[model samples]
Target: CDYELIKLRSVSLEALGENEPGASISRCNTLRCYPAKVPELIQNCCDYLEKNALQTVGLFRVGVSKKRLKELKDQVNLNRSLTFDVSTNAHDIAGLIKEFLRELPEPLLTRDLCSPFLNIPSS
Candidate 1:
């Protein structure tokens, strides 16, 4: 399992290095940029979403471009090794988080939670 994880990591890292127009690398070294861990991205997103439930509806108002999605993923993975701060732009970060969630290859919320999630009493 460890070897597979390492292999996947290296493959992903290698993939990130490739550049394209408007890709994450293009934005790197610009706008208050730094690496961010996946969990940090998730937490930042959760915090923002929890506080501003209405934003979720607006999130889909603007169609997320591929460039933006790539940039968001890059930022999250890049910051994995660095110290986190709340200095990053919240609007952009929130959009990125929403896009990340939408683009996930698999559902983050597992089957176990589906029924409970739906059964939650609506306030």
Candidate 2:
């Protein structure tokens, strides 16, 4: 085995919500427009499903920068709620839900539960 010193370089992950112009919006936007907290973001998603039922076919995707995710994670860890100017950062509620899911460190469902969850009856 050859012992050679090699240098490692750090590269940033791709920015969220940038590839597509209208596909996703900023987390700040959604927080301001819907006036939601980290926890409330999930509730809003539930409400949307309840209100729209199966009729909700179209929905915009949500995206947030890694920096924003870190900020949100910090706030959530510290039990702080997000706050921003509504007029300036108004965003889609659906998008915020998507962002929340995306930023989670682990999948919503555990590996063991995944099988049963997927097996749930559609009816």
Candidate 3:
């Protein structure tokens, strides 16, 4: 790997509201966000959906980094708002899914919609 991609696992965004917004995110499961591809890791952490259970969860940054100029100036996809598919806020993901699936009449409830396919280290 060119750069270190840290994975913070089992980080619950649903429980933690948008408190942090974009600054350093603290979750109930994992620790400091290293360089790992955090998005995929969070998805894999989710357990199988159970009946009448809150299987739908999303993660997002509680606070935004003060360094917002980097993304706009560098034109990079990395940013505090939401850099990867695994959001810092579960509601963010839910909204995204809901905009499409929110009203879907099918079995969207059971659907384990992964953010996106990424080649994360199988550690």
Each candidate: RMSD to true structure? 12.1, 15.7, 16.6
Which whole-number lDDT from 0 to 100 does residue 28 have in model 1?
28
Q: Compare the candidates by TM-score and give the number of the best one.
A: 1
The lDDT values for all models are: 0.45, 0.40, 0.30
Which sequence of candidate numbers ranks them by TM-score, best first? 1, 2, 3
Error of 1 at 9 (Å): 11
* Model 1, C-alpha of 19: deviation from truth (Å): 34
Tell how far residue 68 is off in model 1, in angstroms.
2.7
Give the lDDT of residue 94 in candidate 1: 61
Q: With candidate 3 superimposed using the best TM-score fit, by how many Å does residue 85's alpha carbon deviate from the native?
A: 7.5
Query: Which pairs clash in the backbone of model 2?
Result: none
lDDT of 2 by residue, 1-123 (tens): 110100000111111212234322443333322323333445544565565543544554334454554554454335434443332122244454565564554455858789999999999
Off by over 4 Å in 1: 1-38, 45-57, 81-91, 103-108, 120-123
TM-score of 3: 0.18
| Residue 47 CA displacement from its true place in model 1, Å | 5.6
Model 1: lowest-lDDT 10 consecutive positions: 1-10
